[model samples]
Target: MSMTLTDDGQTFSAGRWPLSALSVASAVLIFAVMQGIVLSLTGGVFDYPLDDPYIHLALAEVIAQDQYGVNLGEAASPGSSALFPFLLVPFAGTEFHRYLPLIWSGVGLIFAAWLWGRLLVEAGYGRAEWRWLGLAAAVLGPIAVMMPMVAFVGMEHSLHAAATLALLLGLHRHFSDNGGVGLILAGAFFGAAFRIEGLAPGLIAACALFLTGSRRNGLATAAATLLPILMFMGFLVSQGLDPLPSSVQTKLSMTDPGDEPGFIQLRLAILLVNLREPGGMFVAVLALASFLMWRATPLKGTRWGVLVLVIGAAAAAHLLAGQIGWLNRYEHYILVMTAAGFLVLLPKATQGAVTPLAIGGVAALILGGALAYRLPMHFFELPPSARAIHTQQGQMARFVKDYLQTDVAVNDLGYVAWQNDNYVLDLWGLASAEAREIRTTAPVPGWTGDLTAKYDVPVALVYDHWFEDGIGADWVKVGEFQLTVPGGFLGGYVVSFYATSPDTVAMLTGALEAWIPTLLPHSRFVWAEGMEP
Candidate 1:
């Protein structure tokens, strides 16, 4: 409760929980519950959403037992991105060690959310606007509901979010308190975030630096903190260990699907509609805040210059790094700061005036959180709808747990592998380059053939609905299962597969034909293998 950790010449204290900090405690509890539900459903599984989660858990487990690297069930090589787990290893002896990330994420989010409100109010959020700003900071944003909802133990995501918040806060403090300590501390956390996701955090920090007009100091601080890490990475490279993957280089080049500028733009635009529509009210508030900042205060010289730099850098970084279509929500942080600058420029005339802005902002955030929670439930499902995705996921997980035989091999199929203890030949292992090759390099005529021939994948869970473009047909659907309703799980079909073998064919085909009607009520199941005739 009263522990201290120093980084970059600054000390960070995990202070004792203050009796007055009940609000923060409550927030943490709420966040924990949300995360716990997902964890429970997934059975503490670490797969899919990229293999980073498994790597983190495996690393923590390895470090907990004081080993260099060991197989964590389904994981291979313990993978790269070890910093987050390394931090937790020291605390691993205690129960809190295992749940360290959960604690940090829950607490970090709450702290960030709380500080955002105070920062806004101090910068210029009127009493009326405080509630809305708080709501916005809590829900809408790049690292909002979705990331936290899925990533309870996901340190990288949470760390990135928390550090981004800290970086923003540090910039805010630099302008308001002329606080060098905050700047240095910001550099450390920001540096760690970059260690996890290099490009985005680095971009965010650069923005923060420009915003503070302390580019020289910010750069120096960042370089100093990151230098050690870089040197370590170089050492690894010398020893023939690529600290990270070429995927990073590809991501930096914006070639990765998610990082592509066009895709980011499209996504950002859609998300920004939250602010853009509804009468341009949020934008109006931002414009007004900027105007006020310019009008009243004698905030000139280093203070104003730093502010300009901070605002500019923050704004540019938002556009450059974040999804372009999500501007409405992604811009939440910048808006908060923009509001602060307005307040500093022209201290609110009356606390009473912000009532409408507060109402508007809060409403926007609630709507955002609601939407954020439900979108993935719907879109990423098999059928692309919420109606049956949850149950469908349950059914798939249950089926795998019950029937999967032989060590399984999959292409980017961590979610399934994580749920059960089958030896998974994960095509998407630590070596993402291999994964890229697997995906882009064509597969054999049937998924089973490809696995057996190329990957020596003995058994597979090939999806049945590739005609619908579900997960692709590089693998064939050897087995089939159906939800009670079509698209109930997601939309299309939730079929199972087994390798092309005499025993597998008979077992899976018979099991499915018998099990399908009983479980789903109005579903059909068939074995595509017999069609060979």
Candidate 2:
């Protein structure tokens, strides 16, 4: 459970940490406990804003099948490498997929707690302030601690949070000491952050060099930090893998429009808005105190360098808004920095007086108490469960895997693709690079594929909504299932179904109702054929 790493980078000290062990273990435990509580509160498989528990299930399935970078031939896309997919594959294969999201959530929370605690201690929080330090860290990292459970259901938010904190901590140490392996480790964290999101941390690193007094140290730090990324890219290239045209970039180019305010205003606005959010008010108060602190201290030596990096990074990210549409997730590390930014200013703000710290601590506790009161009591909104939707999709998948025994092509693939072993047309990612290509010179059409390939897909799981609106008509309806019974959302969970048999013009008028006792009664479904046929 515990280990140590020594100066020579070789032996363990008589008895100590192997560097960040306490942080890692604490993170894991915190993540697990939080996950258990949340899952117990909400039944298993809650998928509201994101109705794709199956996406993760699919990723784990791919890894389970022992296929690396297996695209499942759905859409013009490849699998993502955000890490959680690979991490959860075994669990999914073993029917433990329901708990995968919670596992990552736990990991994120624990790491966040550990990082905040250790970083605060290292930043010079006195023993008397440890309780305040813990409270402030939680308040500052509210998003880091909880959002990973809600918004980051499938992605690697926890790892990203941990890495971002590590990067900042390493950067802080680099500014303090300025030589040796710590600098290299700082660079390594930078590299890890780069792999997470290219623009934010990269911009921060670049700006740090420009703003810091040690041009050589800043530049050295930037170079060393980027080394891991460069090496990783090089390895990919060597393996004949084109890391560019990457899933992250391709997805960004497609779904998101690249237009937003400059980084400085945007970053500032984010803090304000986060503060305004029911869950973010405590963070907002801490942010105000932090800003006050930064104003008092400004920047001295390495601290000044770190400030320069923060400002520069924020500025550059804003200026390049035309190219890299600002997705808030990309800037999650800002949570940790804002906390550090406040500390850097603390000494000057207090001016050797204990009063400012005391007032600030009390204010943080009050704000945090208010936020904690509101989130669960008033905003106790939970998403619908995937388990409810899974039955019919699972039944259909079982039919295909057993009786039908043929490949399937779905237009709007979600959990359906993951439950079955059939091939998918697209999996909610790069496969539909239509959105991305349309914003470019050539203006390409998305999903430009030959559907009538050698492999015959006997079952087509199409959703009528894609065609009914006439927004997209690439598919032909072969069959349908309709429900005549008056149906309404039952406790925020809607259950409805439609079935289309192969070559059937649609099922009987009330086939949906007829199969109600048989099928899982999905929120929506359809049976259809591809346009190429």
Candidate 3:
């Protein structure tokens, strides 16, 4: 039940194995249980809760074939994470590709849990009752930060969380113990590679080092952080694409373009909007509590203060420039880093006291759990969420691949593109720079028609309301796939099928008629008005 420092004085031994190894085992066990629940609900089909993973898989498939985009031979930067698709390249076109993201997620969970355990040990939690607390913290920390949900998302976020934790852990070690500079550099590099937003934490930590008089380490951290991102941008530029991914550009364009506010104003506006949400409020509280803990600590002038500063600055930056809730991802890295920073700092701040820090830690956990009140709900909803994606996007992919057997246009491009080799014209602009350019530059009524015609796409499956002004007057609404269950994480409950031209209507209608009988449970295909097979 107690942990003791190993001979190297770097990690703690909790029996025969290191505490980190035990933590990894605990995390894997919890993940397996969650997966079992989801599998049971979904009839043993291993599917991500969101359709987004498939987009990465689609890009990976093409990347494996010496291409870089979802559409074969077309060099496009659609994924937000430049490194994730390449990570999946080895598994691409293999039977194991679909499970690769989940596998990586499990690995990330294991790594994060291991890092959390090591961090607790490094923070002086290696004796008596504190040791038990450290063990509990290692097991519960990931859950508190919603790592299970991040894993279920099956995206780059889990690794992003782990890398961010590594960065913080490195910062702690370098400043407190005058070591771990290598960790700092590796964390900075891989963190940015996983998610571009990761640079925020790395830059903040680097600035902290510079201010703390570790000028050489500061510069190294900065260089390591920027190198991968710059390389990715250069690669995109070389591919004749924008320096940023299309997904990033599209998200930026969607955020109040009409106002055209100044940078400061825009960031402040975004921060305000974030603070209005429950999660945002929780982050604000966490930051405030972390600052107070730093102030209360005798070592405020030391590395502990640096950790608090970095965590606070990173959380603020995320609120200002990053997204918060897209299936409880996006902000997950910040949550994990912040929570881990708090745990590591608590023992030091409390000066090894039992009652006060325990009370404070419990309070913080309760507060976070309260705000994440939806965590349990989301856990149970995972199966239904997967079902939603499967019944909606999965069926869309099915209809396109099995029924139409030709190129198609779609607003949501993940499942359809991943399931088929046919050309998929992304109207929402995540995958196609041309589609993004068209949507952002020329927001007109008939632009979809022109774009589909340019790609020679015969049909489209789209959420009709999403394109209020661009569905095209000439495009026929041939049919729709309506999910009977709750939409959960879907963009819409009903996905409308459209024929790009009048000549394609009969073909689309017949395809829909044939596909109707094959519809999954809790989903129905309905013909559009005045249209029947």
Among all candidates shown, the one with the greatest lDDT: 3
The sequence of per-residue lDDT tens digits that candidate 1 reaches over residues 415-462 is 344334455554433323444344444433343344444544545554
TM-scores for all candidates? 0.60, 0.64, 0.94
lDDT of 1: 0.43
Model 1 residue 160 CA deviation in Å: 2.2
Assess each prediction's global lDDT (C-alpha) against the native. 0.43, 0.43, 0.80
lDDT of 3 by residue, 1-533 (tens): 54544223545444433557666776677677777876776677767789999999999998888778899877887798979998888767666888888888888877787887788777766555576676566666666677766787889988988898888878877766647798888899999999999899988888988888989999999998999899999988988888999999988886653466999888887888778776776776788778987887664775567778889999999999987777778888888787778777777677666666665684566457546646667656776788788778878888888999999998887888984778888898888888889888877888888898888889988998888878877898887789998746888998888998999998888787788888878889777779975
Residue 401 error, candidate 2, Å: 5.7
lDDT (Cα, 0-100) at 107 in candidate 1: 54
Question: By summed lDDT, which 10 consecutive residues of candidate 3 come out lowest?
Answer: 4-13
The residue ranges of model 3 lying beyond 4 angstroms of the native Cα positions read 1-22
Per-candidate clashes, comma-separated: 25, 17, 0
Q: Write the residue-wise lDDT of candidate 2 on 1-533 in tens digits.
A: 32222212332222222223443454454334444544443355343223344555665676576553324433232434334556677665455675575565556556655665555444444224333443444343343334333333444554565555665656555554533335334534542543445335544654565565556655665665566556555644554555543455554444333355565665555544444443344334445555444554433332543544463454334323312212233334443445444553453344424465745653554355345434343123222222333333444444445544445555434455565665654412333344334323333232212331323343455444432342122334434433222322112222122222334213322332343345533424343343111
Worst 10 residues of 2 by lDDT: 487-496
